[model samples]
Target: MASIVKRMKLGSQGLDVSAQGLGCMGMSAFYGPPKSEEDMITLIHHAINIGITFLDTSDFYGPHTNEILLGKALKGGMREKVQLATKFGIKRVDGKIEVRGDPAYVRACCEASLKRLDVECIDLYYQHRIDTSVPIEVTMGELKKLVEEGKIKYIGLSEASSATIRRAHAVHPITAIQMEWSLWSRDIEEDIVPTCRELGIGIVPYSPLGRGFFSLGPKVVETYYEHDYRKDLPRFQPENLEHNKYIFERVSEMAARKGCTTSQLALAWVHHQGGDVCPIPGTSKINNLNQNIAALSVKLTPDEMAELESFASAENVKGERSWNKVYSWENSDTPLLSSWKTVE
Candidate 1:
């Protein structure tokens, strides 16, 4: 039986998707060794069978591998059943990750993603990162062209500042803005959330479980493999992970009182943020997928929401979300449009 999940509207352009989305990054890369393609396909099929219809992937996730995986998974009659979301703009060159938002690059990336996904039009296409080098309007203009040509259904921005979002929205209606918003990552609430609410843009939180910190606890970080992306993140560092244990412990206690798993509690908090907000929690295991989907039913009381909010406030978090200096571009509170040089 497919679980009956509520639908949420993303962006003002009539983009409606399942309230909780499935982030497909881990099935291809990032968390650890890539899961077997057959396993991931089965998992995605199960997700759809259970009513999780919003599937998120990125052309850069596997540097073109993730979309390929999704393409294979959505074969037959599966593609039409879900709202597919994929991102572009981040690419690896000379073994270094680079951001590109040039209008030409935008069109090329979209065409390539369509080829990889084996789909005529992407349901929602997001700029993986704000390319400060190109004026946001230029990138948005290219995306607008894609929409007009029926290459993409709607446009979105990821890790963009409130100012950049406003500028991009002026060019076209941004259906959704993806950000790191979880119980522990509340920085977006300071300005980005308010701006999106005012602009009628939908919010899609990428790491709503704090990169598995909220659900798996600090111990999971200790065992991360050298190749695992989280091994390089500051929050998962030895000292910071120890300090962050307090947060997991507190959340576990609260979950115990609520008679739900810690992950369910964590996801429920994000779900309560607003109807316009959707959280995409990724997992390679089917058990974890079922657990995450169950979160939709773990409704938190107003008092519980307040208490958890106080406990998981940004100040309570002990480490930076990313240790890479390049990631600062995504974390900036203010847009640095003038500081960026165009890619030649």
Candidate 2:
């Protein structure tokens, strides 16, 4: 908690939160492997005690499992210490995605999340993906009503285009926009950032660690598990990883000179971006959580920021940031954070 989180409201009148939030995605799945519930619970409590206030989760992770986990984690007065955010709307079947933002579904999802998280209200609710099957106006309109009913505090969108964002905003002023942001990705800088600023919405950057690629991330996953999803991703392939290490390789060297790990540098880099930008880095280990908390204190000078950017600018990291989906489609910032995503 050494670095004061430059927290701002997700949207004007929205709840205040730590400048950097905690992405709860990795605790249940993704990255290298699945973590035990006991370990994840410990990590969640640790994160809370350390003043990391933003708690992120979604119904999609285990198709209702992650939210349930968080519900159990917040069994006590711990719920009062957090600014919880959970997403709904993206439908999943057999591990494949099916975007569904129907208004009826939105209400149903909200109730389910409430029951899963064991909370009276979700602080900030988001549409996990833009459901083209239903109009954005129709979906957001229902969300506005939820706000009125006090079922949710604020609304946010993920992986949505500028047009969709604007349409949603017209229905209700968005509190924050959650998506992937890191030193490697820049797609939102040009449009999304500007729009959020103009509308007074906050930006919550998920995977600020580049899916743990910035430092100390394993080279690969041998076998896919029921909860593990990274094995199917392109970046995990041996061929891509072999070439992609170049992006973070330099980061490791920089960390050596700075007397920190590549992970520290990555988190520091996220903090240096802007007061409005909050990077949520997820980890299920107490040691890593401690290290992540320490990142709030890792300072980078303007020159250092430029240097890091300069070094990352040249390399083309292999693999795609997202699989074949509209949200995973090409964007500008992908090259910087997702440099290794397309190397192969």
Candidate 3:
């Protein structure tokens, strides 16, 4: 079957996936209450049929439900059509979030995710958050074993610092680095982006639409549902949002000049970052998914790219990228390899 979405090599490794992946986190968790299972299944199928094959989700999303949902959606011979990616290491226990990367936990999580995803081999598996308690090498050692066991084909790290990425890649060549990278979330560009480029690792930018701010604008905040977590995000707070809205406004103005929707232009910017980049923008609605796919066609020249960058330069943007300090890339480094006994 011909694919509408062009495929690219995600890393120097043999892992190739669609140019743009589908982030399935919102379908079962985070943004709001769980969406209808039937609807999400249909949406996943629609994405695959349209050639958006790289599906991203995590056990942390819906705790466990999202993987189960993907398992269901991949039935009826659909699993073979796309690259499946899921994550582990972040768990909510007793109302507190904990990150673990011990070898025992790594093996358990991988086995559990395999069962939940109902797949023989996961194409890409990422440590959702760096576990500071364990050495990066120790955690990656277990993942390296998974590759040899054929449990996972490729390894990835999320929200990792340049140093941590370097350390983890030494243990096992990291196929990709998943980070929050959008127009407003540009901190990663200074170090993380350069590190990945230097190591020849592919970068998968999550929240490439700035958590929907660039698309829906400040007015969209008023429509948040009761459980909408975005309402509590720093950038979405009334005080910061008042200032941040201007960034969206400027992006909207440029988008209008380009004859595209604000969301399309915002997504296009990520698409244009480079061929090594693939942005996973999540949407529960088919219309939004189609619109995001159209972003691949919204080409940008060097001058326009610089103009867009100026609108959301770090100084002009307000609020922290994440409310939790644990998620900051600066805090993503794990302990030194010598700090822990090497696993045999």
Give the number of the best model, judged by TM-score: 3
Per-residue CA lDDT of model 2 for 208-263, tens digit only, reads 88776775654435434565666666776778777767777888888899988888
List model 3 lDDT by residue over 1-344, tens digit each. 45679899998998989999999999999888899999999999999998999999999998899999999999999999989999988998899988999999999999999999999999999999999879899899999999999999999999899999999998889999999999998888888898999999999999999888987889879768888888778888899999999998999899989999999998999999998999999999999999999999999999999999999998998888788877667798776776566542
Ranking by TM-score: 3, 1, 2
Candidate 2's TM-score reads 0.89
Best by lDDT: 3
Q: Name model 3 segments beyond 4 Å from true.
A: 342-344
Q: Quick one: RMSD of model 1?
A: 2.3
Can you list the residue pairs that collide in candidate 3?
none
Which candidate would rank higher by lDDT, 2 or 3? 3
Compared to the true structure, candidate 1 yields what TM-score?
0.95
Q: After superposing candidate 1, which stretches have Cα over 4 Å from the reference? A: 325-344
TM-scores of all predicted structures: 0.95, 0.89, 0.97
Sorted by lDDT, highest first, which candidate order results? 3, 1, 2
